[model samples]
Target: MAVALQTLVAEAERYLASAKIHDYCPNGLQVEGRAQVRRIVSGVTASQALLDAAVEADADLILVHHGYFWKGENPCITGMKRRRLSTLLSHDISLLAFHLPLDVHPEVGNNVQLARLLDITVEGPLDPTDARVVGLLGSLPEPLSPRDFARRVHEALGREPLLVEGEQMIRRVGWCTGGGQGYIDQAIAAGVDLFISGEASEQTFHSARENGISFIAAGHHATERYGVQALGDYLARRFAVEHLFIDCPNPV
Candidate 1:
């Protein structure tokens, strides 16, 4: 079945409330393609590899978490950017990307989907007063040692996470998918026994150590893989269009 490109974009923007969120990049449709979309390809990032794979799959539209035209990036579309945009234009594949919207969504957000995958009972947002931060606070059904929790994350994400073991057993947990290690302090202030993020900074180690809380840096790509897939599935079910999620493995 095929759906009009405009209709799909409108529904996606409305579902994610993209206009209300302030993101580093514009949300929703970034590139125009064919008038109708029959098949959708979703991925964590819209890299050249993904575009190539989508072309091979003959996708009508490409949905991704990361897209071009950032807040501070160079305006000129040259080199890698030129190639990426050219691919989309040449193939007539629309590019629809959602960044913070995808991360903060209550149902299909990266953080929420990750919690489900790891069996964490969500309590609430990591920072109650701040609406901008999408990190979450949750608890395991039972306390597990830091190493054990790391093992669980590894098993679930199929990647060995970097763990900073603390002295206490892990019961209360906090996490943000992708490059959200900056929220470690916010998680610490929330009194979580452990905090997990996709990438960690140098100060993150000191903060975790000084605060005496466990920390885990799961691979950025691994942690953020689920949300786009879930969103694609939802769109597929809603519009009766085919959806394919392609994972170009990134060790980072």
Candidate 2:
């Protein structure tokens, strides 16, 4: 039994509403397509290649982490943008996107999933005041050597982590999945011994050294790919819709 497009969209939208996220792009149903969705495809970005793949799969809808109409994007429908949207519109494929909402959903969020994989117990949001804190602070079940924890992260995530060890053991850690290096200060203020994010900047080294917080930079796209995938699986099982996750490599 397939789910109606309206129903699925409503579920996703309601989920977003509950989170109260501040999103750069709109949260749900960026493009309208068939009224009924039997097959759904999800990916990290709505790139030209991903749209083509969705079309090939005869996907009724495309779910992505990064959708169109970003804050700084030109409103005009030009080269790359035109190509991506035109393909979906022509195919009558609906587009549903959840950015920060997907990152902080607690049950299906990227950060939550990453923490679960690393066996970290979430204490609270790194930024308590912000309702949509993308990062979380947590403590390890048992204290592990920094090197051992690094190896565990690499093995679980299937990618080598960039590690900067601090002076103390990492019992309490902070993590924000995908390009959240800017939150290192907040993590430090939260008194987490280690800060982990998907991407690293040159200045992050100084932040780690001076702040005395251990830092780890996992791959941005790699860390984030799980949340949307988990959401897709959940929807598929709950609503009996077929789903596929399209993978596109993003090294940064």
Candidate 3:
């Protein structure tokens, strides 16, 4: 089965409500390929490994959370950029990416998906006052020690998270997927007992310690692996096109 590339992109844009949310990169249809798409390959990032896997799978379109043409990236498609762009152009594989939209979406968003995997009951946005922070507030079914919570995260994500244990048990929680260390303060202000993000800055440790809040820095790739897969499944069900999620693992 196959669907028109335009139709799929339109559905994704509409479903994600991408135009309503501002992002660091352009959302939807980064590179154009075939008019009709029979298979879609989804991943956390559009790294060379993912692209090579997509090529091997003979994917018609590549869907990802990370894409090209960022807000401050150099425009010249020279080194790695040239290789990636050439791969797509040579293979005629379309590229579709969504950034912030995929993070905060009510359905199939990274935060919400991670909540399900970690058994957190989502309460609301981490910072309702700040639209810039794409974090969520949630609670565990029961209060668990910081170490126990970290173990749960490790088991779920298949990666050991860096835990900065606070002086309290963890019940109320907050998290943002992918390099969201900047939002730790916002999460603290939200009054969560613990905060989780993909990366941590040097200052994050002091903030967590001083504020008596637990902190976890799960790998960025590890935390964001679910949303794209959910989105791909949605598209597959909607359009009857084949979907594949290739996890080109990243330690960072």
Q: Using TM-score as the measure, name the better of candidate 1 and candidate 2.
A: 1
Q: Write the number of the candidate with greater lDDT, choosing between 1 and 2.
A: 1
Q: Residue by residue across 155-239, what tens digits does model 2's lDDT show?
A: 9978889999888899999989988999998888888889999999999999999988789998898788888898888888879
Give per-residue CA lDDT, model 1, range 84-169, as digits (tens).
99999999999999999999999999999999999999999999999988899999999999999999999999999999999999
Tens digit per residue, CA lDDT, model 3, 81-153: 9999999999999999999999998889999999999999999988888788899999999999999999999
Estimate the lDDT of model 3.
0.94
What value does the lDDT take at residue 199 in candidate 1?
94
What is the alpha-carbon lDDT for the whole of candidate 1? 0.95
Q: How high is the CA lDDT of each candidate model? A: 0.95, 0.88, 0.94
Alpha-carbon error at 200 in model 1, in Å? 0.6
Model 2, total clashes: 0
